[model samples]
Target chain A: METKKIKLPLTKEDVLGLNVGDMVLITGQLVTGRDRVHKFLFNERPRKEEIPFNLDGAIIYHCGPIIRKSDEGWRLIASGPTTSMRVEMYEHWVIGEYGIRGIMGKGGMGKHTLGALKKNGCAYLHTISGAAVYLAERVRKVIDGWKIDDFGIAEAMWLFNVEDFPAIVTMDAHGKSLHDDIEKTSYRELLRLIGL
Target chain B: MLKLRDGIIELYRKVATSLPPDVEDALKSAYIIEENGSNAKQALSTVLENILLARETSRPICQDTGVPVFYVKVPIGLSQVELKDTIIESTRIATEKIPLRGNAVDIITDKNTGDNTGKGFPVIYFEETHDSTLTIDLMLKGSGCENTGQIYKLPVEELGAERNLEGVRRCVLDAIHKAQGRGCPPYTLGVGIGASKDQVTRLAKDQLIRKLTDTNGAPVLADLEKRLLNEINQLGIGPLGFGGKTTAIGVKVGVNHRHPASYFVDISVCCWANRRGRLIW
Candidate 1:
């Protein structure tokens, strides 16, 4: 019922109020995953206690980064966002199932996802597609990898502790969707401008 | 005559490593010039930065180092290379250096290999032309755009040329609408007319490598492209389908003469991040 605006470097007291199109800089822990990782979680059904990363109030990125073995550790060559729509079939279930508060990926969410976001107090964040290298810079650490060798880089489930991960709020919990609202208003404006 | 094996290998290497000039320029220009008030524009800016970072850091553009799609135009009289093997070997090398994600999965066996190189990894299409040099167009197609691809059949009896054209326009709009916030808008449309179901589908996929700025000289098709572009934009799908006037940067139609018994049309759409490249040898 009450909403608040938050700034970057979000602290415990600060709340993030993201509109659908607002560019945001996130600082904190974020997780990385893809279809394989999702299926693996669904099949394994890891206990809440046994889950590799904490899901509460954490942002999960639907991405598969190109990682190569290096002297320091695995090096991220490109880790861009994948289209989130394909994972939509599983996302709502995952958000409800895992208590995830935020999701980061390119492309907007569908109606079902919007509903899930509303019911679950979650938000859908979008980033630039094909901008892996630029995005990788925000990542400060690779915390731990669950089944790293099994799924490989693109398909692997790797947890990342990141800082200032840039994103836009595309869907919100209050049924306020920046994408839907923008499309509606913009179309009306275009129609008026063109006398259509 | 360039040695067949060597030439093909070289061509494959070039195609795999570098992005096509037109495609690269268009993407860069889109980021700079195209402005829709959505994450799409910001994302485009980030994508440009990412591209630069990827090149500078020697990383694959994206982690899902996509399945390779090759379109080769060979000269009939050019005595140069083993085209097929060239594709295989070049793909193999590119998979190693380009470090592409191993996407080929054995459908029946259900096996997973991490490297993006395997049997039928670089899907190659070859055409023999009356010329000297060979032109190889390669596209690193990720699964996101690939999955959004669709094929709709319109029977000739029910939908004649007028209707089929209308049908094509409808299909494009439907795809954009249904794919809202998916397929990453400010995208490109590939339309295939004529040919069998598989043929039409393949034709549309091949056009993914054609740059948005390039236009074939058929007046009818060009007009179709223009009309489809306008209609789809009117849907206000915008960039990334976030709602804007620029849903598609361009629409490309690849037409083939089909049999009279029945006619078919298919449409394939690619996101703004069209990851394709070109090479000649």
Candidate 2:
């Protein structure tokens, strides 16, 4: 697999060429969202003007980062992906509504997301799930955040400036998904071990 | 006498910032075994690098510092109530000093405590000891892996499992399979068997704290642990479920006698992080 370096505010053109198993070094601005974000967008259906961060040609990270405020600015202590599958039910709508081109997280999404990626020319990028401190080093600055008082730290939305952040593409725009394939293959092995 | 509050704070720092040597050793070996070009190998490499960086920086290994579960042992004539209060205060201090992510949430209000403590939060359990020494063991149980733990009521009709050791093996395998890669394997599993639900759940968590290199004291349980681990690795769920040769590093099991009417088994799965440590004074 080839390594691709991406500048953020990704366009459809940027994501269409990528395929599953390719490595990426993403640099630029991205927004962090998790269970609360997905639930709000899907259930509450906020209009474009009401939303705090831009989503057009943007990448949404499934993360709840550990951030601290200093006189200099904000510092991100630990930032890594939470499991993406938990928000599978709401991601397709979020992707289509916001013109999102990239979904970054760990433990890849499901059929709905795979379908949405194929439909919207998006891709799923899987990062090292528990490698929080190392991943935090990539965040040059914690740009801003919203809904901290309402959603709490672990479930709030935050924006960050990241450089050379690493991840692997596990789902691509062509309806290909690495997580799906592994689940099938492993299920067969499990049955065989049980003598089924 | 050692200051119990201060000692507990130190334990929090140790558990969050760095992994125990045995866990680090397992990850190092897992990295070597995974094929160089494969996703499994690459994931392990990042994890190993992260472990060192977390230690040097003294930051959390994972963003999810998780719910702190404390197992406290107090010597005879000591005040258990006072010890409980000390643990709570120490937790509040650690949350700010360690800068840990506040994880405790109010179920009714949907609000975070922001200090990692609340009504029945941090989940502390106390037991009286025989000796003069005081001991405290803490496990920072992350919800991702903790969510994957399964409890089985045996005589499983579908798996064709009976109430025997063979049946226990089947249940453990099923739990691992259901967990897949979501909990972040190469895992260390703790299995507990007993007459009731609560008994096995604690029994299993107790098994998780045992050293990976130590042999099981019971010959029969030891044999089962080895066999179950061998079978688990064969599942090919590898690091992060990306598929590789080493799916799990170790499996430990505990057994308890039960009434003839009931059989329950609990499986507690810890991810690659497996943050656990004990303090004795």
Please, what is the whole-model Cα lDDT of each candidate in the order they appear? 0.67, 0.89
* Best by the lDDT measure: 2
lDDT of 2 by residue, A35-129 (tens): 98899889999898787888898889999888777888777789878878899999999999989999998778899999999999999999898
Tell me the tens digit of each residue's lDDT in model 2 across B1-281. Answer: 23878999999999998988998998999999899899899899999999999999999999989889998888999998888888889999999888888999899998999999999889888889898988899999887788789999989987767898888998998898888888888999999999999999999988888888888999999999999998998888889888898778989999999879888989999888999999997
Question: What is the Cα-based lDDT of residue A153 in candidate 1?
Answer: 62
Q: State in Å the error of residue B156, model 1.
A: 10
Q: Using DockQ as the measure, which candidate wins?
A: 2
Per-model interface RMSD values are 5.1, 1.0
Q: Which stretches of candidate 1 lie over 4 Å from their true place?
A: A1-16, A179-196, B1-19, B24-40, B75-82, B155-162
- lDDT tens digits, residues B1-281, model 1? 23644554454444433455665676666556556454456666666676667667666666666777778888886433566765676555556665666677766664556545567766777789876767877776666766777766664332232336665665555555556656766777787878589888888876676667777789878888887777776776666655555677778988888877646677777766566665666
